[model samples]
Target: MIRAVAFDVGETLVRDDRYWTSWADWLGAPRHTVAALVGAVVAQGRDNADALKLIRPGIDIATQYAAREAAGRGEYLDESDLYEDVRPALAALYAQGVRVVIAGNQTARAGELLRALDLPADVIATSGEWGTAKPSAEFFARVVDAAQTEPGETLYVGDHPANDIVPARSAGLRTAHLRRGPWGYLWADTAEAAAADWRIDSLHDLTQIVSGAG
Candidate 1:
């Protein structure tokens, strides 16, 4: 039985259109141009951070992130940024006495942001805080440890198959490939993604999927 479920943040619980658009605006680049690069990067199984550097050559990433934070506007996401399927799906899992965690490659302020949004999760972790990112065995091991469950008892749900599903499965967690975002749909037929225990069109389908998994 799955005792806990770990989720990816961007494109899984939330759509980051406004967030990326804000970044593009700050960097003085066309939003559509940056957004296309982002999609292309994910499609090619490259890191989003790598795409950022590619988009703006010779820009210091840390300095850029700091600048965005210092501005205090468009640096954080709110309830409006979340997917319609997020709240209900999380609520349903909570009602089942399942331990829910939001574990993803996110900024240092992600915990504070999620707190402000009042997301329904027992624990929220960001790679910046955890000191490791997805697709790394160490990170997934840490996530399972944080959940206080054996890896086999944990289920990871995310849109990114390479970072989220494949690695989590390798770390011994069952995986659900949620096919909602560009990476999700685009890589749906990939060998790594196809290995997920379950694949669903929406997060709302998670309630039934989790229940059935039990």
Candidate 2:
């Protein structure tokens, strides 16, 4: 039985594309351009946080664009809006008595982002806090330690195969793959095809998986 569940923050639990699209629009460039830039950065093997720093110069252009959009509409694009869409699923997991923790690579701004979105503080665990990244057995081990759960009793759900599935499984934790789109190292036309110990297409599907409803 799965007693605890861990999640990845960016694309798995939250809709990262929303923020990227917003940021792109603010920069007065096509969204795909920014997407390509990010892809290139990742291709270069720079971690997400470091890539952001390398690309900081381009951010001003986007910020200026967003400012103009806000002025024109007399409203602001708040990152908090994205959280509203995700909180219900998180709350549902909590209600199920599954100890939920976020195991991800993030920067110091992650706390600010979480607070801006009003996400629960008690459940978070990040590389920024832990000083390691996923796909490392040690990283998952740390999560297991933090949750006070054994490997067999824990499940880690994430979008990347290398970062989420392979490592979690290696560390002896059960795994679930959340298939959102064509984004990660893992590709499953549907969640069922992901070949994880369990598979889910949406956050709502998680309740049944965790509760053994299926």
Q: By lDDT, who's the top model here?
A: 1
Per-residue lDDT tens digits for candidate 2, residues 1-214, read 8888888777776656665665566545677876777666655645443434444555454355456556772123245544343577778878888887777765444644554655642467677678787767789999898767899898887877667777888889888887753345435543433657977677777778888884
The local lDDT score (0 to 100) that residue 198 gets in candidate 2 is 77
- Kindly give the number of clashing pairs for every candidate: 0, 1
lDDT of 1 by residue, 71-169 (tens): 875467788899998998899899988899998888778767876777779999889898898889999998898878999889899988888998999
| Backbone collision tally, model 1 | 0
Show model 1 residue runs off by greater than 4 Å.
Answer: none
TM-score, cand. 2 vs. native? 0.71
User: Which one is best on TM-score?
Assistant: 1
lDDT of 1 at 116: 79
List per-prediction Cα lDDT, in the order shown. 0.85, 0.67
